[model samples]
Target: MTVATDTLQAVEAVFAERIEAATALGGSWALFDRDGVVASGGAGIASLDPARPAPGPDTLFRIASCTKSFTAAALLLLRDRGLLDLDATARSFVPEFVPEIPGDLEVDPTVRMLMTMSGGLPTDDPWADREESMTREEFSATLAAGIRCASVPGTGFEYSNLGYAVLGQIIERVSGVAFTDFVTHEFIEPLGLDMRFELSAEEAVPYATGHRRVEGNGWLALPFTGPGVFSAIGGLFASVTSLAAWGSWLAEASTGAERGPLSAASRREMQQLMRVAPKRHTPPALPGAPTPPSPVVYGYGFGLFVEFDDRFGAIVSHSGGYPGFSAHMRWHAASGLGVVAFENATYARVSQGAELALAIVLDAADRVAPVSPSPAPWPATLEASVALSGLVNDWSDVAASAVLATNVGLDVPYDERRATIEAAWAAVGGRTAASRTPVDAECDSPDHLVWFLPGATGRLRVEVRMTPLAEPLAQTFLVKVESPEPSVA
Candidate 1:
């Protein structure tokens, strides 16, 4: 797969844009093109000491849930050996892995469901106490027993970390090895990833420290961990260079140029759309704004999010965050334009940075060649709509409140604040008219839409900033929603 120089230059511009955007938000990032690191930016939180220097291609950052794709790929490797069946029930291998529901509610969720996150298992609450202390087995069992099915088995999409955790268990059962060990033995060693699930003190010295912000003060380092517990869900640490090598392999596997560890057919299957998850339900604070979903639909084959740009006629690829770190890898199979971003921040910061990086890449790609039409839109689901609406509402409230408190007087009552904000928005131009220009746009997920708003000087600006819930809560940009146009008919 060859990328033209012009296309590569556009990608470089995008990378530079993201680096600037990320630094403004006080984060650090590294980006890679097919050949290698084209550009890098922001030592911000990643560097506490100015003299220490910024992260480079070899600097390691935790890949977080991006690990799930590798885990899913490993499972496919097992499938290649006929060691396990994708269609088999969870109970087939781990007999004790039964869903702990009432007699009438018993549904034998298949391994496919787990792989696609449609396993009908309870979505794990990252904040829950159950997650903190439970062993992997106990955690899986608890979720299986307690999860309520929102839809029939393998029906609707619900993002479930628990489901992937179960997948780790399946890999263990089939490979006769622990999940991490399987990854190490099969993929890491074969590819020579030069990465590991955990770092020793010596290794840690050179690695970027994950950070979160303190409410009143500055950034602080986050607690560190090895990939012992979250091996299947959110683990794995590597440099951008090594990850680009992995991405190049994926591009080859997807395009039939090179046979990956899995067969080409299996790789294609992994990239096919499995189920459409609900959209982010939080609304934009301003009227007529568009709120993007997490992923319009998820593809089981690749074990990652696939966004379709009808205008671009391409599949936008993705994978993302966990507690202590975040990462993103995207490639347009048709164009051979790819971007890989790695950050050592919490989930939100990484996600924001990833989205920005994606926008930068897509903008560059568009400049190189007139982007082809996007693939057909996947079927929308009620679940997705609900999720999207909720996100819009949340975003709307937050934005409105911020505007009222900062731009207007701070002592306004809740109802009055909303009314004032709405009135202010109406005065600006009303929801029916276009008021703001999109500085940048990218498909963040299969159906999720992301755009950037520019400040007066024409620099891209983020709408909302978030601090992690934990101590040393890192500050990162949050998703910004655009107002929708009123119907003309």
Candidate 2:
């Protein structure tokens, strides 16, 4: 078996140190595996009040645009329920999002465009954050006045809070329930998440005041804003504990290990790349860490964006920022490990800290000696080929040619293959029988099954490729034997 990373301790240490170096007011962090939470804790204060305790696992922080994924999922759940069409334009439901510019109408800006952030609306984080508490009337008025389009609806990547706000509006109109109510009931409740769009005192988590690092004035405390039109854009309030749970669930979804409320299929669909985020940059490698050299390009899904590394693979995640808080979460789909971090400092870029910590953790994981991954089920076609291998021992015109493609027989003429096998048998002094373990399912060849068998003296490698014909034939066949050095007479 492969060595377990047991990376919880290392991940936590790096996470805490990163937060300390970032000089944020205070922060919390957690690490998780696909099955469940691995480790969770927080450093720094949750509230400035002396009477209040330091931030703990349950302390609440505004998750900001991380809420977008929930909004996107909510939309998908609506689709799953047949309440809305992803291809339908926002005008069909809300009837208030007036598109100001008309272009070559190949694909209209539908719910899909909004979910993918490809609606051509200009990147409006600054404007959107402040409007988190906008009333429905105000939002309607703003949209009705006509929306600006930076490019044709489906042509470019522009992160727009307006698009999500419109989606929230559509959810409201179609479901006949407020966005917060419907979301809390349908999505949050099912996931067992203690997430909220509004923070209050009576709940388990005490509200951590957001602090702004002023140019010369030091830290200025900021209050949490409440529900409004754009609330769907960045209105989630949760703890690292809860966020870790969220990340863990999503990682499981990625591998179809766990499905709750949202089917594994739908969850996987939500994490798919819909648009490339051009502005994302390669996060600086962690200090003194052996990071795999991989290009970092931000690609958006429903509400998620993954940064794919060539050697390591996809890290699915999203970051959040509000006036007084910053948060981020990342999980490896296959590995099911992730990091979630939250800070009570405005624009502190906590996302980078989470990213750096994950890199360090993953680098550590890479050094681990890997246990052979479990194989997928052996296909029946491949099983038949293995059975055909029995006939190879007594090859004749009909026996070899029946299962073998004409080209395969030509490549290594029956005579050449027969001679190769006989030579190995001669070295062993007898034709030693071969035995094979179960076929490795991780074989990546789309049309071939490749495996090795432990023989009496050495090993035998078997490879069979499928042909393009009605009856399956071995397009290519290989049998290689590496005999141990001949025993001294």
Candidate 3:
């Protein structure tokens, strides 16, 4: 579906405003759907020292922890090959991951636990951010020296960069290649994505430089870290075009679109909620500020955040933050619309801008067309509704039995059910059954339906749900009078 030109401009404006509001040197954004990038633009400068313009679609930016999803996918590929079991102990591959949990529990975390961020390790961010340059041997020795965990293994959500780093080691042990090489060969190359751990100094001449704000010194350019053992946690540098492509491909898992390196099922699995994240308390709203948005509950999937919204369905997203860069990628599962954004500044919180940009497109789409398709009633369920209408009109025990399941009669005897239906019709000013058939039918699921029968004074609301059998029978049936609105008087 084509988004309006005005809507695209509104999207670009979001990022342009963010660069100034968030105090970042420069930033870029892209709006994408299942087809491809719908619109993209950049704002401010890419680097302050060199004074380069804002990054274009192909300009590289460090994605930080967004690389976790890639690390998780590699393990999934190995699992599909029967080379590793998700339930297997982490020590099965790397014996150095003997974490010291509270109460000195003997329970060890499985690879799946780490993937879901439920390995009981404490939230390690800025600390792990600087560990990028540590060599593989140093990482292994650090792990062997005894890593501390905050809670029991597999008990709850704890954002652990250490846990994912262990997964990278596991990948190297099983694939017989470095973690970076495995991801490059298996995912990046196969999918034709332009992503890497680091770019050469000459190659990065035009790349966006990472930065931090110094009180007296404006924006200070930070040096980039080289790839090492911790690269598995948050080490990849990617362009907005590449990041959008990766996110859109994962969103297509629901539609079972073109086959890629990962199977559609495995990709879908990556977006499924595995553990509920801790709730965050919000401060009281100020007098003149806009009302707070509906509460969003978050859960951890394979390597992504699954947010459940009241208006929209499941939304998958992940944010990345390092010393000098911040990034975010998010997509609505039902609509397949998404946004990718990056800022070359520390703790920029560019996600706020991306969220606003996405909300605009989704609201626009909802006005033009349904963001998600509504489910239709099954053919058998429609037939059953017709039969039910006839039974209500004629009141034959045999006819009612044919339309309903045996449990319907056992739960509420047929005699009482018929009496209820007759009383409801009488209240609607109908002595005899109305000639009108069912109208305004709607379905929440294929097996369930709600419709109305017009009466003289009011209408009778009928709701029915079918059994789950080859030849389904009406398992739930209800009829009640819905009176017209009361007069203003």
- TM-scores of the candidates in the order shown: 0.64, 0.80, 0.93
Best by lDDT: 3
Candidate 1: tens digits of C-alpha lDDT, residues 114-140: 888887766663642124224666665
Q: Order the candidates by TM-score, highest first.
A: 3, 2, 1
Question: Which 10-residue window of candidate 1 scores lowest in summed lDDT?
Answer: 282-291
Better of 2 and 3 by TM-score: 3
Q: What lDDT, from 0 to 1, does candidate 3 have? A: 0.85
Query: Which one is best on TM-score?
Result: 3
Tens-place lDDT per residue, model 3, 1-489, is 677997787777777867767568888888899877877888888887555655888889999999999998999999999999999999889998898889988989999999999998999898999998889889989999999989999999999999999999999999999999999999999988989998775673457889999998787889999998889988999989899999989998889985689998999999999989975332332232222223378889998988776777688889999988999999989988999999999989887777777777887887888887668899999999999887666688999889899998998898888888888777778843553588888887999998888877877888899999999999998777765533110
| Candidate 2: pairs in clash | 64-234, 376-441
lDDT of 2 at 226: 84
- CA lDDT of 225 in candidate 1? 66
Question: Candidate 1: misplaced stretches above 4 Å?
Answer: 1-45, 49-52, 101-103, 128-151, 280-302, 370-489
As for model 3, its CA RMSD to the true structure in angstroms is 3.7
Candidates 1 and 3 compared: the better one by lDDT is 3
**lDDT, model 2:** 0.75
